[model samples]
Target: MADSSAPVLLGCDFSSSPSRRKPVVLALGRREGLRVQLTALECFDTLAAFGQWLAQPGDWVGGFDLPFGLPRELVQALGWPEDWLACMQHYRGLGRDQIRAQFAAFCRARPVGGKFAHRATDGPAGSSPSMKWVNPPVAYMLHAGVPLLLDAGAHLPGLHAGDARRVALEAYPGLLAREILARRSYKSDDRAKQTPDRLIARNDVVHALEMGQTRLGLRLKLSHAQRDALVQDASGDSLDAVLCLMQAAWAQQRHAEGDALYGLPQRFDGLEGWIVTA
Candidate 1:
């Protein structure tokens, strides 16, 4: 059994709009020494439900899989506020159509290869641009998520100030998963795309994490059932959440060693948030 008094850690795989078929998955865990243990998995079928859960009283550090801020170049080009808080406020007021129109116009004017403005962290993290609206639709995720974190009063280090007990760090699961999978596709939401090869890749990812093969150097502890479940989820949402959990564990370790920025670079663009492990 895990220690009851250990501080809780969370890894969230978020979505802009959630439903019973596609929920936001949160992997709840705790780090003991260099080992991170999976404790529970929570799924929220609605954004309002997830918001309520985030607002609940708790003492936890979470690595949330959503972009916390936009690219500085994109914001500046759009004439949005330079200050992170002010920018988020202005962003929240615009409709999705307006965002699409403005962002589309911006992209159309740019060179073919340099269409999307990227955050400084993007190079290291290898993540999709936060402003992307189609495919993964991260822009919508940001629009839906940042407000909830703010309303929840969770402290976003170097971005927003709020509850000390509930620290929220931006996380990118692909950053860790790619370190192990190396472009091998481990998941697909489409039923037809969830092939046997992807299944193998998911299992490989779980095995690597258990062995502490990643640069994070923290082993993941799981019960047999938990291990099986992580590998068996065809969509890989659960596994992605666990990957975020590892990043959260790493940040926790850094905090224990006295880095208040929670493993983020000491000098990163405030208008473009950094991923925890990047």
Candidate 2:
């Protein structure tokens, strides 16, 4: 078992251009034995501000819901640097339009079913391609997120190095949620789309977390207001953040048990990061 009081854990629901309409959500918590407490929640209006938060002095292992690298096949095809750091450096220098055009051009010649190349981690993680810039625009999230994490000196397991005490792992809440909900939509950004059924799903998810039903063997302890806030956020950002927090807690537990990659596979591609616990 881990010590009675573990280091702070973080779950970040990132937005490339976070604003009032879509602010970055952060969940802060600590795990003791099997119980993880929901200590607090915060919102950041910009990536820069979130970077500032990352730079703060703290010991934490965070599960950030963003890709930390592009697919190795994609990088090789583009003739970008084979090295992850070099590739990310090159990627950061491009504007969003340039990114889109470049990706589109890459896909233009490929067959329809195989338009986009995938990271080895994608199939299992159910993550969008890091090169994808539309719909969820996760590619941009990677572009916007990783550089800041690098600059803040947060260590990205299997990707980049920084503060060992401030470790950050690639996280996907949907991967965990989907294991239980299985294609059921539990959240919608549109208020009109936030129906009662999704509310029930959210409630069920919360109940599952509190009951220690996931493979993580972790239970959540939330105050009355905190639980209410998680259920009330129909967008599911809060719940997603919590999901990622549980991932962080689970990873920490694995680390404590002597899994150096913090529960990630021993052979995950360094070029394409693995989602925690996936």
Candidate 3:
């Protein structure tokens, strides 16, 4: 059995296009009393490389900023492959243009008010509409990401079954960051908004995590060197992964409370568990 007392929390900032310029940023750590200590921060240059890391046997709870599933409506309307694994495989096989054309066709068929069909997790997390192609391109993210998790055989608490040693949860850094910073946008990959103030905001967000002010009630405990490393990464990938790690910590706490399938409550509508945090 894995060490229950020191389960590692992994937070990942993934890239749809995993390359030298846009590699996967991973923050590895564990909770110590009130603090979430940073043990390591690493990068992977390809999805295949990241998948290999995820498949390794270990006790880890991870929050990945990647969509876990496609919108149900899209699945049904596109007449796409049904099995989750097959669906993702088929989707991934298509070129970007083909994927866009199919998605666009589905959108054209849907009514204006219901432009996006949702995944079971969406309602609870208040996540971006899965149909969105830009801004976050989460729909495409689902296409790019979910298959790797499934293939790696990781367990998606509340969604799919696999090895318990590796738990994969969908997380959104924007949600946690916005909760504290509200409307104060920080570090964008877009060069137009990469101002010093944005960098300062990102730093302030990290400081806040270190101080334990977010809803997770978990402070970031980092060595001076680790702190310096996180601060030095201008891309904000390491910091984003740490933020996801905190969210995973919160989900783990909730799991201990008997909500084994943890996620945000869906908005007042009956769509109960739309966003599976754990």
Which candidate leads the pack in TM-score?
Answer: 1
lDDT of 1 by residue, 1-278 (tens): 55567569999999899999989999999998889999999999999999999999888899999999999989989888999999999999999999999999999999999999899999999989999999889999999999999999999999988998899999999999999989899999999999999999999999999999999999999999999999999999999999999999999889989999989999998889999989
Q: Candidate 3: global Cα-lDDT?
A: 0.74
TM-score-based ranking, best first?
Answer: 1, 2, 3
Cα displacement (angstroms), candidate 3, residue 100, comes to 1.3
The sequence of per-residue lDDT tens digits that candidate 3 reaches over residues 1-278 is: 22347668889898887888779999888875566777888899988898888877778888889876676567767787656656667777887778778778777877898766776656545578766787778767766777788888888764567887778888888778886688886666767767888777777888889888877777888888887776666677777888898888777666656675644442422211134342
What lDDT, from 0 to 1, does candidate 1 have? 0.93
- Whichever of 1 and 3 has more TM-score, that candidate is 1
Q: How many residue pairs clash in each candidate?
A: 0, 0, 4
Off by over 4 Å in 1: 1-3
Candidate 2 residue-wise lDDT, 1-278, digit = tens: 43545689999999998998789999999888789988899999988889999888878999999988887878888899988888889999999998899889999989989988888888888888878888789989998998998888888777776778889999999998987788899999998999999999998899899999988899999988999899889999999999999999999989989887899998888887788887
* TM-score of every candidate relative to the true structure: 0.98, 0.97, 0.85
Question: Please, what is the whole-model Cα lDDT of each candidate in the order they appear?
Answer: 0.93, 0.89, 0.74
Worst ten-residue run, lDDT, model 1?
A: 1-10
